[model samples]
Target: MFVESVVRWGAWSILLQFGLGVSAGFCPPRCACRPDTMEVNCSGKHLTSVPESLPSDMKRLDLSQNKLKTLGRRQFLGLTQLQEMDLSDNVISMIEVEAFQGLQNLRILCIKNNRLKIIPVGVFSGLFSLQFLDLSENEILVFLDYTFRDMGNLQLLEAGENDLVFISQRAFTGLQNLQELNLDRSNLTSIPTEALSQLQSLTRLRLLRLTISSLPNNVFRRLHRLRSLLISHWPSLDTLASNSLIGLNLTSLVISRSNLSAVPYSALRHLVYLRYLDLSYNPITSIQGNLLGDLLRLQELHLVGGNLLRIEPGAFRGLTYFRVLNVSSNQLTTLEEGAFHSVGNLQVLRLDGNPLACDCRLLWVVRRRFRLNFDGRQPTCLSPDMVREREFQGFSEKELPRVFICRPSRIIDRRRQEANIEEGTNILFSCKADGDPAPTITWISSQKTLLSPTGRIRVLSDGTLEVRYAQVQDSGMYQCTAGNAAGNDTLSVSLQVKGFPRNRTMPFFTEQGWIESSFPPTANSSAQVANPYPFDAKTLIIATTMGFLSFLSSVAICFVFMFFWSQSKGQIKHTATIDFVPRASMGGGGEGGDTGRFTMKLI
Candidate 1:
């Protein structure tokens, strides 16, 4: 009985050792396996293929940053327990269908930083439970139709930094639960309104480094649930249509580093619930009055680095709950008191990195320095030699007058000016003002818009308004306000541009009354008029057809002429000869009536 018991115990111990050995054998080479957590990591292993013999019960696997060239079919078929997998930062160019067939539980998958040019349909067919997908930093040219139809639960997708030029309409058909999507750094000239509208639950959409020039009206109307819109690096973006955001209920709107020269008052009127507004890093020179009158709920406004030179009175007329205002890193020398008359509840105000001239124009701000928040960086003076770099907070109420001293501005040539000229005429209006601290000049158009440096109408450095090729639309009263720290002055000039008949050639008349010809003779004396257009296929075809027709006509005329001449040669010939007697014999018959006999012969 003792011998039998020893043999049975030995057999049980051997079986236990074999089970332990089998568990260790399942872990692939150069991989770290945690049996307790059921996870495997073979990342950065220079792996050319998915490691084999991985634990089937592994819930998470990372194979990122390797030399993987392709993900073959059934690469992770047996890893049914994998809830998260990362194959990012590899040279993976091709992913066969069913690569993750059995990974039904995969909630997060990353295939970022690869050479994937196209995400073929069915490549992600079985990932029904995928929630987060990262396709960023790839060479994807276009998102094919139904590429992600199975990923209905996808919440976030990062497809930025790709070479995408177009997206199929049905590419995101089944991704109805996608919320946040990023397509930054793409070459799409316009928004993919159709494909993106499929994500009914999308809230935040980001598009950067695009080439879109203008936002059309109601372009985002289909995005009912969109809340946040961020656009940046759009160099060609300039105009924002009045109704561009008509149907958008966006709470936050950010547009920066663009070519927006003016505030989009018409578009912003629809965003009543918008809280944060950022137009930083644009070329906007002035903030027109009543621009943000409708955005009553707006709390924060940032125009940092907007090159703002002027903020007209009533610029922020309707914002009662305004909290923070950042206009730092700009060219603003002085801000008028009326500019912030409506924003009485203003809390944080940033005016640093600006040339704030200490004068009467800015006295109201200095008096309220204690109440206003400068965001830890106070406004400093750039003029008045004594306080060139001094902060406004440094001076007290009693010392304010002695430190920030300046004379009020007055329009020396203030007068009711008028000019009448035909269209296509160059005109100039000069505005002269006098003050202790020279005031800046800003021209306001008849449409209540600030005129910046444009190719046609430009404001010279000496406050001269130069309007080239003036049109009828240029007619109106132009208000030019010159302002400094002390105060400001205004001068209004009425410009009436008469429109000539369209068919009539518009004259090129200068401000000096010189009549320049509209069609100036070319300097080059070449007989051929310079063709500004390139040779296209149509032009080539026309030229060839004309030449062929000319050749045929010439050949036809030559043939007809030859046939007539040959036929005439076969006709009978007739010759007639008439001979007269000697003139002396004829004269002998009668001196007055000398008649000679005529004879005709036919042969």
Candidate 2:
């Protein structure tokens, strides 16, 4: 009986130990735990502090969106195996020195969107394996020495959107493996370049909307591995010293929306491999040869929405690989010849919203040899009243009059020679001119009749003659006389109408480029026919008959080829069968070889 009691007691103790080990993974109140993954989720709970009874070997802990105010020392003492800890969106104002003491294997720690004001030195003392640390959107004002000295393996440090104004000299002394650093919107006037240069692995840095005014020469030469640098929204930025961007290997540079009256071209001479450059929304006025001389590898350049007025010849001298050039919205009146001579590879050109002068000087743009592709709305003529408001894409030399010359008071009209219309139709004759001052216009006809605004004959505000009804009597030589203080000029136009008058309401031209008459069709033997398109009815009938005959010929040829193809296919099949049978019969039976040979001879 004594031996049995001892055995039962030992068995009961083993059972109790087994039960305790299984219960360790049980879900806690208002919290969850996964035994398979060893993860603990206690997020969105009203817990004032981290729960002490969490699993000791949890790999992930999510304590986000909680009311935790402070992290006491040894709060995570036993969570040595936790790889990721998310304490974001919490009221964590204070973190004791040893708050992350035993988290030697933690790889990611997010304390962003918290109320932390200061990051005490050694706060991240034992997190040797930490790679990413996000303390952004916090109240950290100053960075003290040795604040991040213990995190030697950290790669990314995102402390943007903070109140950081100053950083101690030794604040980043031991962060040798850091790669990316973001300090945007922090109001930092100066950065400790000496300490930052020590980080050899740093490749990307952003200093957006900083308070610094000017950049010294070679300010970023020490950042040897930097590939991207962005400095934007510096409202007071006006000067960039010579060699400011020298001795660096950057691929992208963006300095936009600043107070730069002109680009610091002297400083950008060192960006040899720059592929993307954006300097839009600046107050730059002109582009000269020295501004963007020899950037051979540049691909995209955005200079939209500026005060740019001119682009000197050879402005794009050495940019052979340029793909996009945007210079929209400015007060440009003309361009020198070969302005884009070197940019042969340009794909997109934006030159809209500029007051361009339309004349022989723009023949380069109208020629097919240029082949320029516009990006947005095409430029319209803003001068030489004849072509005013006409898009450059469709303007042609034929639209100019044969004797057209932009004089003080000379009228320009497309129909200066002659015009043809139906007797009962309406027509418009525009006589627009350019002069130093305003010009007055008058109209006269071949029959010595002074034309004025009458029943069916009216003159537009722009001195355009309108004829509502067309009659044989109305068909004659019309002249437009323009007089100004400088001089007086005249332009002649001949109107020819074919057909009898429909009604006798004096025909006048409308602004809609049409002629209207208040007359009924005469439709008598003397009436003439009207042809709207280039070809007459007889020519159209002949073209339609020829097209139908050509189509029938094509179908007939296809049918003939198909008929021959069927006959050829049948002959080939018969020949192939005859050739194949002899070989099979000869190989199968030697005695029947003579029969096969005879058959071949007959074929």
Candidate 3:
């Protein structure tokens, strides 16, 4: 009975061991002894290769930061149920063709910070369901064509911080569903026009290392759906062409650095929807009149780091909706009297870092806009001569001097002339003057007509008058009258209306080589007017001679007066001294008197 019992027990034990071996294939290599609910964790185990016989029901696999050199075929072939896979921070040099052939359900694939030089063709061809692919911080130099052709469902593609110099056309052809593509800090010099042409669905592109100078025209023409574009570290750009961004729908554009000079009007013409623009780090000298008039939707404008020298009167006329304006780090010498007149909605105005010149015109504007000063900030004088020994640091608006003065311009010259009217000839009549007030101008024609109001003549505010499309009947003496509040002046330039070819020939005289007989002889006459004021030279000679004679007469008179006065005083003193000397001896007194008389004569 005992031997039969022992035999049955030994057979039952053998059956139990066989059943355990069959169930081991269904579980991971490390979880064979644990309960069924225990997780199959194989992370950070100095793993150099994908472990064999992983549980088919495993939900998570963390193979991050492993010294993995390469991934071969059938590595993750059995992980059909796997959802997340982390292969980041590894030495993954290469990926075999079918390495992820069976990971159809994988959602997150993190292979960042690896030694990948080039993504082998079709390496990710089977990952059709992958939503996130992070290949950033790798050694990838060039993206091979069709490398991401099958990843149509990818949402985020991070390929930044790589050795990529150029992006080949159609490299992202199949990634139309991608939403965000980060290529910042890639050291890219130029992006191919067709590189992002296929990514129509991309809404955000961060090109952080894209300097303003390397930005090419029409580079963003196809990115009509882009909303936020970051182009930082671009310092050398000066002008932006109007059509450079023809079709982009950008909302926020940031371009910083200190080398930019001018903010071209055309640069932001098409950015009609732009709400925020940062043009900091430029040396913009002037803002052209009506330049920002069309940017009605601009909310925040940052002109920091630009050494701006002037702001024209109408420069900010159209920016009525601007809220925040920062104009720091500039050389703004003057803010014109009406520089900020039309900007009613401006809230925060930052005028720091500028060597502002505090003068009458500037002070007037500041005083008018005192409410715009947020923190009692003041403008400083940049002129060394204006501020004595102490530098012109900023002062509060209340502390600023109430009165300031300006010097007037000096007078140059005045002249008048007349000419006969000539027919069938275009005549140009002008009266030029130079002054600070930009003289008020008027014109009158021979027909007693006010020529300025006529459409035939166009008068510029700067005192330039243009007579357009003149006819023969328009020939007559034209008078140009200009004046300021201080003084008034008039000049008449005669326009001869005589028939042409009749007086075309000139007469030759003995003294004058050629003379126009039909034209009257004015100050510009060919002979006598050659040297105006003929008596000027003779008058100068006569004045010089008279001055020399007068000087000699004055010196002679002074010498005669001094000689007579000295002789009278000496004779009087000598008589007094002889009288004071008493007669000591008769004979001695006689000798002394003779000597004294001789001495007095000599004196």
Candidate 4:
């Protein structure tokens, strides 16, 4: 019995010793260890380097916020099963080429917020399965060629907030599976589009806080698979060329806080598949026709902080699928008709913080009540003094036109404003007037006829009369008449064609005191005219005829006024008069009290 009891005690002692040895090997010094899960938390331990005595089977090791200055080779040796490792916020300034040689199965590696100056080539060559690599908040200056060639399976790369000034074309050559790349706050004026072609599989890319003045042509070339792109906070970005985004298949594009004075329609038209577009915080002034027409798939548009002044008709032509549009914090005064006609699917409209001139033109918004979201700050009217301080939704359409009467400017009826141009050159004559209905302009010739757009005469959309290849016959007074429901305004412009003396041979006179010549002088004709007056009798006759027409116009105006007065509802029916003289004092009887008579009028 004594021999059997002693054998049992020896067996129990051997088991206890083996268990203690395994526990000691699993737990590292100055760290928190979970032996069951094989996770070591050595963060903020102020260690000089990675623990050399880490468990070989550990899956997660965190050495963050440490004083490790350099990572030497074989640092993680034997840790082949390390699937996630974090050395963030460490002062690791240098990493040896083979420092992570043994981490074959590592899937996530974060070295952010370090002082890493350089990562030697082939340092990460064996991390074939590393799907997430975060090297942000470091001092990496250059990305040498083939720096990440072996990381073909990397899906997300965060290299932002670094001092990266140069990156080779082959730096990301093998990262074919990369999905997201963040290069925010990097010291790069322009991206190497050729190098970016290697990221054919990239889905999202961010480039914020750059100093690039202009986006070069084909800036996003070959990035057909890119889905989301953000290029914001570039205060110096002024010009975006037409082809800047020629080859992008982006779904969301944000270019806010840039100095864009106008919408890059040519560049934006290429983004046919874009769903969300944010152009906020720009200085754009106007939105014209076909500018946002082709963005049929767009669902939201952000135009806030742009200080936009006008939106022409058909600006939102093809945005049938648009749902949200924000135009707040702008300097808009009024919107034209049919501005939002094509946006049938719009659900939310933001128009706050604008000095909106709510006139009859904008009454359609109130009548329709198209989901205007002012966020409690309503837009006020700037016209029709009775409703000047009224909010957009405060009044009804019945009360709008009463005070929205507009008066045409007096300067519109002035005589011809002379403009001189060389023969065979182009000239544009513009006429503008302000009225409640926004007057439509038309051009009339001297022959009491309306002038239509012909081969050389073109009328622009903004009421500019353009005469291409000006000839001698084109030299005459063009009557530009603007008319609306309120009133009509007329202005005559005379175009003098110079440097074409050959057209002065046969001059035709008009009743409006303007000349139109059609014949060109022959080469044998004398250079100077023999007439002493330089003014012909025909010109005098035309001037006298214009004066007679003016006299007739005055007589007709007087007759019309007298006729209207006769038909007036108010009229004087009877009249009475009274005359009084000064009376004498009551105590003293003056010579004689003067008689008085009173007169009154009644309608």
lDDT of 4 by residue, 7-109 (tens): 9999857644442222335556677766556678889998997776777777888899999998887678888888999999999899988778878899999
Model 3: runs farther than 4 Å from truth?
Answer: 1-46, 51-62, 78-84, 210-214, 235-241, 334-337, 358-603
Which segments of model 4 are wrong by more than 4 Å? 1-25, 34-38, 368-434, 437-472, 475-477, 483-603
Which parts of model 2 are misplaced by more than 4 Å?
A: 1-24, 32-39, 329-337, 352-603
Q: What tens-digit string does per-residue lDDT give for candidate 2 at 161-202?
A: 889888787888788989898887886776566667667788
Q: Residue 519's C-alpha lDDT in candidate 1?
A: 40
lDDT: which is higher, 1 or 3?
1
Each candidate's TM vs. the true structure?
0.69, 0.57, 0.58, 0.68
Query: Following a full C-alpha superposition, what root-mean-square deviation does model 2 have from the true structure?
Result: 28.3
C-alpha lDDT values of all predictions: 0.85, 0.76, 0.67, 0.79
Per-candidate clashes come to 1, 14, 10, 7
The regions of model 1 sitting more than 4 angstroms off are: 1-25, 341-343, 409-433, 436-603
Model 2 C-alpha lDDT versus the unseen true structure: 0.76
Judge candidate 3 at residue 232 and give its lDDT.
64
